[model samples]
Target: MIADPEGTVLALFAAFCRIGACIMVLPGFSSFRVPVQIRLFIAVAVSMALLPVMWDSIYPRVQGGGSNYLLLVGVEMLIGVTMGLIARYIVLAMQFAGTGISMAIGFNAAPGGGLLEAEPEGHITAFISFTVLFVLFLSDFHHMVIAALVRSYSFMPVGADFDPRMALMTLTDTLAGAFMLALRLASPFLVYGLIFNLSIGMVNKLSPQIPVYFISIPFILFGGLILLYFGSQSFFTLFVNGFEPLYLGLP
Candidate 1:
């Protein structure tokens, strides 16, 4: 059964190239906290597991080694990265919303460590980001992503023609969707901040001697925190619900 060990090994690496690249930029798997060795091992293990299913398509290509093989490998990387970016953009959108929510709620503070990157984030923003990521994990996001990848082979086979225009369009659409989602999630905070600040600004004009602005901080913080406490569960639920349709349901 294992007559062509070298051929099988080459095919395996070919599969690994794509999968490993995807894991490099995938959301939870790509976090700075996840060690490189662990990610590499996961990629290899996934490639091996998937090799049997993809063998018919990939083995023939590997057998004919040369420019075509190299090109196929390159295309696989492109496809993997593109798929990873689709999901990554969604996560970034949530992080963007977290940042905006913090600003709106007057919770600005010294930047804390990022949940997925080196970039600093507000304390509350970091909390929200990590919590949502945890929820995604519990929801078996990885299984969904891998399933999507398996399905991708049917539509975008190895060494498929890369369409830059189509890719750009998809990126633009994702950005637009992400922007809209972020805005929706943060809208309540925006409205509350606006009303609170306006009322305080007017009070300051009327009673400039009362230090109205200074006194408003505690109340603003209290009200914003209360709103966040009540709204967080629903907010995360909406995000989780939308993520699958937006990325996995792609035509």
Candidate 2:
């Protein structure tokens, strides 16, 4: 055992700074619906799991006490938060596309409770979002997240000054990729909405008395649900496949 228990505890806290921050924002664990105490304990557990491996690098740094040590702690927390943000952006993209899908199919409904937040969503949209998340869990994506966290020490070594510019670039790239992914997932719905609306416009032009939009609503909703039903499996498969590669981007 280490001779100085105080120093050891401080070293462990240094490790916790990263792991806890990451867990607080990571996909499944980050949900506000999750109790804070549970998340905190999970972070502590993960920190303990990682400490043996990280001790050599982190312990020495804690010994040199000063403002610099505090700065290291702050930077470690920032890096952890940034990594968590990288993961969060993907979920945002999924939600974005799901919302677009809801609107495209005229499935908009009043805001309701959700796993992450209470927000406006259709039944189908909520289902898709929940299913995607569930599938990610079933696929052991959390394990992937933990693996990436382990690998992060090598990329942003303990006590090293993490570059703000690098963080900015990483965040920028993650956003860009996530946006493009959202567009891809929602494109079919976009096209469907466009074509369906345009056709409705033409029918209205030909018959001015008809409640074309009202009548077309049923058709559009029906068609959209059919498309969604057939495509759901592939849609989720595509998302899960893209997640890890985008997450473990060029480091």
Candidate 3:
């Protein structure tokens, strides 16, 4: 019943090239803990599901089947990778902010295994990273990603010439936006640490005999914990709210 089996397969593969490449580097789905087989299956499943929706756009492009076809695949993968990297960079920025928060709150205990990664991370940093990621999942971040993928064809159609300059600028904007979001998230703790340390310093100067710095550790840590307890809800809310703007803004 199929009019052209070869063309159908080519179109499917073309779809997979973009979808699979994106999944290969996407945040939670691309984590080290996720098995390669699982990721592959997910990419294939998503590609197949989306193929029909994209058939008209993809099939026409691949019907030619020549050297140009190979170039199309390469460009598709590059665009996919760029899209995935934008999301990845935003998550990395959150980790960066977590590190800052841990340092600011005097929570610099010895690093342990990261909750989501192979690298070691301080307790507070790990907590923030995991919680932020968890909240993102709860908010259906994957759905957002799928929608973006569906829309991507409109923004960068099949077989179109790759624009490295535009891709680089988009990535640059992502980094700038992500870091600014990180800074805002960590700013409260930074200010808290500054004021607490300065006040402790003044006390130390007034009473030079006492071990003020050592004694103030518990006070600072306790205060930071209290601050964290009160502000955590707002912190996460801001992060979740910020994710959409940053992601949807991407090209």
Candidate 4:
């Protein structure tokens, strides 16, 4: 095919804009460690590879006045950002679960940086979140993300009026799911904390002079660690399983 220099360059730039927006927030790609140059190159490459297929659909919509081109580009960026955030929420849910578990087990100290962020997290919760994210990548869950990106064009074409209702609904549903998943992952810790607390309360009642706070704190921490070691794999498996359905539902 004869190359039309102007069309080719515009198409590439449009694709780059769409993809750069996506990589900026998408999990894995969004990680702090990924150098900006590498991310830029990947975005450009992916956009270009997909360009021929998307050009006919995207270009016509973006052409005309410069203002119209900018508007279309902004809409594409919005679509990419929305999808990336939705996928990233799954990881956030796992982190939230870790935080909840930490609070329950008495390891409420702040979490160290690595997988999710440098903020405080329950030790086990952090571990589980990191593990689940790793497994998601290993299991080829990212393929679903690429599929969704392609499918998004059909529902949210370039130059079409952006729908705030769908975006709001997407955020609400994903956030709700993330919270529920966090609670589910931390259920074991929750149960352990409840039983341990109840038993400690009874002991305190029986012996008023005993200092239960210091003693029970260590006991709960140890028990939580043990439970985490044993149950984490299963918890992450369930988490990854849950992610699949939620991801497929995204527009």
How many steric clashes between backbone atoms does each model show? 0, 0, 0, 4
> Considering every candidate listed, which one attains the maximal TM-score?
3
If scored against the real structure, what TM-score would every candidate get?
0.95, 0.94, 0.97, 0.91
lDDT of 4 by residue, 1-251 (tens): 74566656766677677677877888877777778888888888888888888888766655443777777777778878888888888788777777778888998776566656655555666677668778988988767877777777787776787788999899789988878877887888999999999999999999989999999999999988899888877887788788877776733
- Deviation in angstroms for 80 in model 4? 0.7
Q: Each candidate: RMSD to true structure? A: 1.5, 1.6, 1.4, 2.1
Judged by TM-score relative to the true structure, which candidate is superior, 1 or 3? Answer: 3
Question: Candidate 3: what lDDT?
Answer: 0.91
Q: After superposition, how far is residue 28 of candidate 3 from its true place, in Å?
A: 0.4
- Clashing residue pairs, backbone N/CA/C < 3 A, model 4: 98-125, 110-120, 111-120, 111-121
Report lDDT per candidate: 0.85, 0.85, 0.91, 0.79
Of models 2 and 4, which has the larger lDDT? 2
Rank order (by TM-score, best first): 3, 1, 2, 4
- Which pairs of residues collide in candidate 1? none
- Output the better candidate (2/4) by TM-score: 2
What is the overall TM-score of model 3 with all chains considered together?
0.97
Candidate 1 residue lDDT tens string, 122-155: 8887887788788889999888888878888888
Poorly placed runs, candidate 2 (over 4 Å):
none
lDDT of 4: 0.79
User: lDDT: which is higher, 1 or 4?
Assistant: 1
Better of 2 and 3 by TM-score: 3
